[model samples]
Target: AQSVAQPEDQVNVAEGNPLTVKCTYSVSGNPYLFWYVQYPNRGLQFLLKYITGDNLVKGSYGFEAEFNKSQTSFHLKKPSALVSDSALYFCAVRDGDWGSSNTGKLIFGQGTTLQVKP
Candidate 1:
């Protein structure tokens, strides 16, 4: 089984400062990691993904993440935080190696609320 953990319930950052939302995962085999953002009364929007290749993956809205296989971590980072960036961030993962019975479902972490204040 694969699972994602978002240790922080909320992350507070001032505008113009860098922000980070921590995420870690556990899986039986290689992992397909992804990040999504959700606004009030809105569905989750795709941010980035790490299928393979580069250790660092960039995504929408000036967001990026570093894939650290050694630590089983895929932490989301932004060089500068903005008030508009404040939203619920989610980290999701799925096992790369799936069996016939596997549904290829993604397990998401408890969402982390990013509060960017000016």
Candidate 2:
């Protein structure tokens, strides 16, 4: 079975400090990893994705992620945290069993709440 794990339920960081949210995935074939951000009562917005190629992928809002194939991990990172950036983060994976025809259906982790203190 394919799955994703977000080890942390919440991450607290001071504004202007670096922030990271961890994620790990399990899959059979090549994994398509993605990160999404959700604000209060809103749908998740795409942050970044690791489909192929580069291990270090830059994303929206000055955020980036490193795809480590050996470790089976894709962790989201930001150089500095902002109060505005404090929101729910989700790590998602496209299960290959379902294939690309139905790629919209994503298997998501429980999600991590990011709290940036000013």
Candidate 3:
């Protein structure tokens, strides 16, 4: 079965400093990884995805993620973080094949809280 894990329950970073939210995935076939962020009163917003092509995938709000096939990891990163960037982050994985039985069903990791201090 496919699964995702965000080992860290929370990540702390200072304003203007680099920040990372870790994510690792396990899947039977090719892995489709994604990152999402949720604000206090908003829905889960797509951050980035690794379906194919380059290992490094860039997404919204200055966020980027590198898909490490060897490590099965897709950690979200930003060179500089803002206090406003603080939110709940999620890592998700889907089967590489779209025709699979669980099509469009993503296995999500435990939520991780990102706290950015001003």
Could you say which candidate leads in TM-score?
1
Worst 10-residue lDDT window, candidate 1: 96-105
Candidate numbers, best TM-score first, in rank order:
1, 3, 2
Regions more than 4 Å wrong, model 3: 98-102
lDDT of each: 0.97, 0.94, 0.94
What is the total number of backbone clashes in candidate 3?
0
lDDT tens digits, residues 1-118, model 1? Answer: 6789999999999999999999999999989999999999999999999989999999999999999999999999999999999999999999988778878699999999999999
Question: What alpha-carbon RMSD in Å does predicted model 3 have with respect to the real structure?
Answer: 1.2
Best by lDDT: 1
Clashing pairs in 3: none
Q: Write down the TM-score of every candidate.
A: 0.96, 0.93, 0.95
> For model 2, where is the 10-residue window of minimal lDDT?
95-104
lDDT of 2 at 39: 97
Encode model 3's per-residue lDDT on 18-53: one tens digit a residue.
Answer: 999999999989999999999999999999899999
Clashes of each: 0, 0, 0
